[model samples]
Target: MLKPPYYPIIYVRGYAGTQEAVEDTVATPYMGFNLGSTKYRQTSAGKIEPYVFESPLIRLMKDHLYQDAFHDGQILPQGPVSPRSIWIFRYYDVVSKGLGNGERKEIEFHAEKLRQFILHVRSATGQDSNKDFRVYLVAHSMGGLVCRCYLQNKDIPDLEGKPPGDWKKKGVDKLFTYATPHGGIEFRKGFGWLEGLRDFLAINNADNFGKTRMREILSLEKNLPLHSLNNRFPAKRVFCLVGTNSQDYGISRKVVGPKSDGLVQIENAYVKESARAYTFRSHSGAYGIVNSESGYRNLERFLFGDIQVNVSLETLKIKMPGKEKNLSATYDIENNVSIRGLPIPVNKRTKDTFSSSFRSSDTLEEERTHLFTSFLLKTARLNKRRQSLGFSIHFRILPLYHQDKRFLPDRHYEGQAVFDDRLIIEVSKGGDSRFKVRYGWGSNNFKATKNLEFKVDKNNLSTAVIQLNQHRPVNMTAAIRFEVSAWN
Candidate 1:
């Protein structure tokens, strides 16, 4: 059995509306987390076959050798089993007549209970020992908020005397949230019939159902990057899988419009400085983001994947009119990444592309800002063992140039420039996963490729920065020199 990074996984389910809703939720076996879909319309372009997803829980059990602990009627494991276990945090069980003790609890209360649950998980799985403990917290919707409250808000005690924010020291190692509204949700109200109804209802109030839907998530922004969670554990370990298909999210989508995942806005589904990826799946339904392949693939990649390649544009040199032509330039930087063997890319960046712009009139102070276009993936696959990352960047320039006084638009002024390269890295199965990175660029255009070798071990990181000119190769070229360490 594979060990180390393969710790027990605890899943926290989202919120339920009323006591009846809570009862309905607890009545299910997997608590909606184990839901699967056999029939569905084609999710891809030029495809007719329906996709079949056998739930995230099943996939985790099948792919990673994880098993549920409950054997008889006991909530905890009765006998010795695999170290790797998956448990549904039945927080709503308290509300159900058969299970949950009494009345429903508040967010803070739920967070405290979750902390206790995690402690229980730690004790049950032999993770109480400092050397062999770490849990991956996977949550959907409001569950993510519960996790955030535990990770960020509460000051729970650890193995040692619980210092302030001691929970940040260890226990929960990483987090992956699905379609969670990290930022507060906002119903579109500028120009619509629903806007009138929303205004009539005054739904944004903190006391209403709006607060229940988004109270914890709405307040997550207060815990910025400098806070205990992000600073202590680092924001890089957290990932937000954003759902973009608001069409299937039901009535909430109609009110929130197409830019949301029905219940939550897509733009608000990410934590600051955390790694995020977007999919066309909805928040939940037949087309739910949690059970979909894209969602599962991304989750598996971020959780199980070893290599993390953070792609960024280090510097840019633009060849523009030297302020004499009365012009201003803005270029949008586009990023796309694809794994060699996968049928579709991990993120929907290529299809529904997202671009960040840079203006020519911007000062040097603006250039000091660090911009990153990033994604994560599991390096190794069964059929295709050796992992390869296909990365590409496109530059779209919008030049507003004036001939006389008014800025004149030119139809022929538009141009497309791109940088494409494929990195092939072979990962070792035994001991530490050894990797070597080699980068190259061509003298000509988009076809430029490189092959410079550098070694990187498990914990050690290797970086390479290459300069691409206005088109491809003309002005700047740097010959980088680096010391090589032993690959073994």
Candidate 2:
């Protein structure tokens, strides 16, 4: 039987909302909206109760307790075992006052407090004496950032230093983080406009905690290289679950384009270079990914899966108009065929002058930029497993014809391009699974413009086969065929 895990899980909540308000305030901008909203709430004398999202924490505790009751007999023979414990770390001052001028100081203090809490837990449970005790952290929203501060801070000798000689030999592991922006949020653009406005307010600006300061601390390009929390901890043992949902809040839904999990964009949630990132949800669970069953399952898989998950950019393509001589040229994805042999325009009096001028002018740059922007706008399949089925539909624009006169006027023609891709996963009962991807791109050019289609099916585990087809206009006489194959 497999030995039970040696350590318990620690849950951390995100910004503004506490473990209690997770459910209701998730879709809202908790921290960005509530900053400086309260006065006389932070008297230094006794205690300052801060506003927080409590749903995530409550859900986490309840889920674990439920699991313990339901699966009590599942525990294996091990060195140490008991019901898991959870401690909610509250910072009313930081939440109510915002990051303000002393944001870094406040965060540092909290990090130390968390460190002490961890040490205390280790001591109270007598697990520290065993030298085999492991602690796993799961944080959401800004909580993940706070956790990073704690783990990566250079001042914290115990955390920053290498594990004890005995513990190192025994192998201590850490797994934590969910929907945390390893790459800081795009506060300068998009819906982040409000956050920018808040940064200008004095009552909100307590100190360096303003938007600029937050940006400085969270800047992935800057701080990541200097004091990367993911690197500070063992990456192989770290686990992260990101969130993505296309739907946004009522107001944001109309403003933002494409997809987002309300507040955090999907791209921001998953740090490509991080240890392991998965998705079972959107960002608004108020940093409660650790508390959900799906979250726990993903966590368990990351910690114990026979193979780790790998996600990467698979393919990219762009289509553009061919030079004059190759007016018959077309774009195809399957057969790896590209337009070629377009005779260069030679004379100033011929129709070739238009094509030559178009290629020589800034039009080419504009076309290239348009193509690049279109590719970026396209979204790829998410969370596709080795043997899983997936599909995506997107739109593109194709240039059909253009007319230009030296001094008079220039005419332009374009057509709409639409396509859908389908993926199939084939796996033998006892063998490895292979993915078959097929895509079809169709476009209607001009009256004489043909309807073009391309298809490719590849054994993602092995080789690729491609094919192309075009339906000529009823009035057209020309016909073409293309086919190709390549190996990785």
Candidate 3:
């Protein structure tokens, strides 16, 4: 019997520039999927900690019993494979000088090959056409673009003008991308000249990251943006793991500059509407996002989680004191979230890292600012008997006040914040498999209390609203909303 959601996982690696690199990539068995890290940050102050993440590949096998599609020194065994199997899309092998005809193929060609690869996996896994077969596409960097191209394009003859649709019946059930430049990569230091030159010359086929080439590869119209998903796949099912550490990406970080993951800027590393989480890791290296603990946690949760939770500042009615109401001051919101018993935060966005910030005027006008989306798996609970998941969100709101285009030194404090607190949330199963949510402000309470009320809707979504009038600096009427739903 086959299990849904635990379907086969296909890993597509990033770009290999030269023919030698391609040959080297073909020589690898897992295509960097087996890489893990031993060093991690213990705190926000850059304290080093030693933690062993035995790579996503080994962890999946150890935790979820997921096996790789290889046996006895041979790739792809003859018999039927486990449903929870991992496959690598070796798209670069064809272009490798040692492996194939030594012809560099376009990303579109790789995507077309991916289509055939999926079919082969389906057949080799002994899945009949009548059976509902699905797979999860896990990609890094340019690999994500290839997956997107496969999902968004349909002009290929094999597709017959119909791209991947009906995700459950056939095709990718979900996509998890790590440090992918969905909107295309741009240089931060060069004054627009570097980007133009790269696009003009198409250096090393780097034009694949340019808008013109992206539009063709992703099958987007001239009017549509390159990052637009166009509703081809459900945006909610896509998870973008963005990296924010630019310092450790080697000499390339000098050109990419700040507010980036050493190469891809934070703003361009994700799709517009996809669920995103930011980690302070570099693009690729010892501190790379792919080999980090945060990245693996996100991938595991998104793949097998049974519950979905979204947190947002649902309403913000700020009554700025005195003259401050008329003045436009920028406000920065920081969210640091971590699951229970976890040493590192799965999602972190702080002003210091240039990942989370907004103007007070804009936040007031919008009235809603989504903080983050997280997944909770029942089987992942520390105590299986408890059947619950616990997490904490450190939410901080800082205000930068000014008047007449001049900074006000008298009103501003160095480390003071408009609001600073940690919100603790716990979700457990009550009667009839219905979820019971308990929440509390960590600074005020020792534990989560069930006294909070949740409003249930027809869509089976339960919402809990927490007012933010307890420890705020200003007279603000704001509420943080938590929306919870059952997920696969």
CA-only RMSD, every prediction:
5.9, 16.1, 2.9
Scored by lDDT, the top model is 3
Across 292-358, the per-residue lDDT of candidate 1 in tens digits comes to 8777877777777655655544445545544445444444443334554555555653223222334
Cα lDDT tens digits for candidate 2, 1-488:
11334255555566542323333333333222121111123334666655332343344344334112112332111223342544334433334333223232355566666666566545544565555555556667666766666665555445324432222322235645666755444432465555555556523222223435543443334434422443455544555555444342334334333334444544455433455433333455332343343344444434333222121111222233334432321211111111111111100111111111112222332332111000000011143333322222121212344455567666555433312222121111123232233334333221212222334355222233323222322111111222212210
Clashes of each: 3, 21, 0
Arranged by lDDT, best first: 3, 1, 2
Which pairs of residues clash in candidate 3, taking residues 3 or more apart in a chain or in different chains? none
Runs in model 3 with CA error above 4 Å?
40-49, 75-78, 157-170, 321-327, 405-415
The TM-score values for the models, in the order shown, are: 0.75, 0.48, 0.92
* Runs off by more than 4 Å, candidate 1: 18-20, 38-47, 75-79, 127-131, 159-164, 167-170, 189-232, 317-332, 350-379, 382-435, 439-449, 453-459, 470-488
| Residue-wise C-alpha lDDT for candidate 3, range 1-488, written one tens digit per residue | 56876888999999876677788889998988999988744765777767788898999999889998987776545447777899999888888777788887889889888887877777778775635678899999999999998887755433223445644433678999999889988887554788888789875578898888899988899988777888777889999999999999877687779999988999899887788899999998788888888998989899999889999885676555465443556788899999997777999999988998565666564767889999988777778777669999998888776554345544543335778888888887678767788887777774888455777899999888887674346767688888888888
How well does candidate 3 match the true structure in TM-score terms?
0.92
lDDT of 1: 0.59
Worst 10 residues of 2 by lDDT: 370-379
CA shift of 150, model 1, Å: 0.5
